[model samples]
Target: MRPVRGRWLSWLVGIAVALGFAVSALAQDEGYCGDEGVWLQILGSGGSELTDQRSAASYLVWIDDTARLMVDAGSGAALRFDETGADMAGLDAIVFTHLGAATTADLPALLEGSVDAGRKGLLPVFGPSGNDLRPAIGDFVERLIGANGAYSELSSFLTFRNAAGYKLSVREVSATGQRRWSRFSSDVLKLSAIPVHHGGIPALAWRVEIGEYVIVFAGSFSNQRDRVANFAKGADALVVSHAAPEAARGELREYHAIPSQLGRVAARAEARILVLGNRTSRTLGRESQSREAIEQHFTGPLVFANELECWGLPDKEDELP
Candidate 1:
């Protein structure tokens, strides 16, 4: 192992995750992973860039042992999802941040797996409305499985006639600026969505409250309108996209949050910990510079994420940083 040193250590998680860990060594001997608490595993952490090897953005949320939620399903996500030994039948919902292919390209392939797994319950799918450039999520799913769609045979997922004993309940949340949609509320889980601007891409950010743990997936947004801070307030873990480097401009700045803005968002929301994912080749080797940029406005632990890394809250109250 390399020798531990400097302030950079503080920016990384030292919790000893088999998947990924921050370097801070927050004095946690055993990280909260696998406990009764809520844990988040990144299935795919990279952007849709063809030059990179990392899978597209995907996430798996585990409550105890069963995977309860899947945040996004970008391309190459299915392979990583299956690697975690999680079954689709156990998922409570598969929520999308937007209709972008980087966030939904793996839907057909993932749903195709459900046929073999024989899921027996309602799998709720959530996403945002669309514009002329992008199809609304309902139309998006229908195009994949409707009677005259590409995968017409799989239309059973939209109906109740399949012997598989399961059905998909897909809902498109409002994409109006700063709007809120209380999508689901139950004893086991509670979910809320807020419209966020992704350069007119029609996106929404999501918050999932499982038991007492709160997780926020900011998705891929520029936060130019600043809807994320209030929507993500007081989260245990906030996952944001820092897909571009410090010097990026133009379209890159429009589609994703820059490093400095990422700091302000997490800090303003008072998120206990901030996780950086949805990486790209441009941002991969610039962690040091990004860390410097974020530290200007945020003092909390800043975690740079890797694929399949499971992050959990500290098991004991005192273990939290």
Candidate 2:
């Protein structure tokens, strides 16, 4: 579904500033997902709808106390990233599901800020290969920061000619088949992506591996392929973009996972916990129905993720070597 960016975003700055204070206070009081584990932090849990007054789909993967990985920087996500007190420069990589505005609108805003900060580091951006509708991630970045791009003023991101001395390493992956690409692998983290069905739109489902913990970001997907089930098998946490609820129909239902389908996928994947993210107002208002629909198959923990909520992954160090 297309994310509507309207005048509501003008109201976001003030509301976010006020909400940040309350959330920060709550975080200080209750403590966060701990400083020793792999934590899945929801930055923006709302869908493309401007009606919710929430930031669109974005997330962070915190390794220990530092935010090391980011997934999808959607509308208002740049602001949410700032509010979290995260060091944008410390991020190892930023991955996108598809190049929709709901998942990519704030990218240049974020990178521009990083450039201003004079952060010097090569950051890799991983995203899906495009079809006729969308440009591949590489072309997408070139269009934004290439020598003669829309933001040609910030073309240094491509050429690295400026003092900040940072350049984007764009890695475009294909989501055209059953093949799952091993995108990034390091001592602390490993990432893999597989093709997912989002109708004609090229999309991916990411699997993040940190130590013994596994987390899945089922970006934006429909249940027709069930690619996520196998890709996310044995995941400790599965973050599904619940953009459409069980009652949604036609194109709305075709682009996103309905609650019942989500449940079956979670159950099949055997994910330990399911976090429903990228929420729409419709899904938010019908929580009872969605929960019932999901619980029918996935009997494990079900979390209706709220922005800034950090869910810790329990340690399985002993189980791993």
Candidate 3:
């Protein structure tokens, strides 16, 4: 009986040791667990141009492994989001930079995907109110999920607590005339927006703060350099869309920021990291030139984002685990 007890204890100890190693392996491979820090995942990194290699603009902001917010739902973002193995049911809000197809076409896919993933209750959505050329975010949601809208059946199919649950509560930020402004805040996060010139369309740049860390999304801005710099002041990470090259002129200049412009914004904002997103085939191979242009003014870490890449922010030692 003594020998049998000794064998049992040995087996138990071996099992515990193996389990510990397994947990450590998981933490190392994923980096999502055991790390108390903010993370940014690029879902889609391309622009309006459809390529087999890349998707349009979308990003997921995760706080301690739980997805807190989604920024821009561009083409193919849903699939990229799925590949990240994140819980869509945990998403708190969806913020759109602008209503362009490259920036917002995959919203329905995300809505449907979330419902399929057991998302319940209201999904808060925030975006810029439209001008004559575009539809406001509220109007856009109604068009997609209203009584007779395109995906109206979603309301019937996805419900919780015996009621229509998969609903969107839309908040439209109207900074039509304002240069820089803030609108949304909660206990854990604060959201701010500023009007950005994206050709003739109504566009916005967004900044999100979680604890001591700050992330600024310089969404598709052109020529509002000072406003963007002010809005992104001292951000930890600056996400800028590389829409066109520095030499682009005329009407093209009104729509997108060149590489040098993006670098200048990051430098002036005092950002630690610059993520160059919204890449196209034209700008894919010219990374060195872009980096050179950026280095001329900004001396920060530059990352050319791709789909499903996860970036871990610097951990604050004083924060609670």
For all the candidates, what are their Cα RMSDs to the real structure? Answer: 5.2, 8.3, 10.4
Question: Which candidate leads the pack in lDDT?
Answer: 1
**Local distance difference test scores for all models:** 0.79, 0.78, 0.72
**TM-score (C-alpha) between model 1 and the true structure:** 0.89
TM-score between candidate 3 and the true structure: 0.83
Rank candidates by TM-score, best first: 1, 2, 3
How well is each residue in 80-159 modelled by candidate 2, as lDDT tens digits? 88877677777888999989889998988988877666457688899999989889999998888788788887788776
Candidate 1 deviant stretches above 4 angstroms:
1-35, 319-321
Which candidate leads in TM-score?
1
TM-score of each predicted structure versus truth? 0.89, 0.87, 0.83
> What stretches of model 3 exceed 4 Å from their correct place?
1-35, 155-164, 315-321
Cα error of candidate 1 at position 217, Å: 0.3
Candidate 2 error regions (>4 Å)? 1-30, 116-118, 317-321
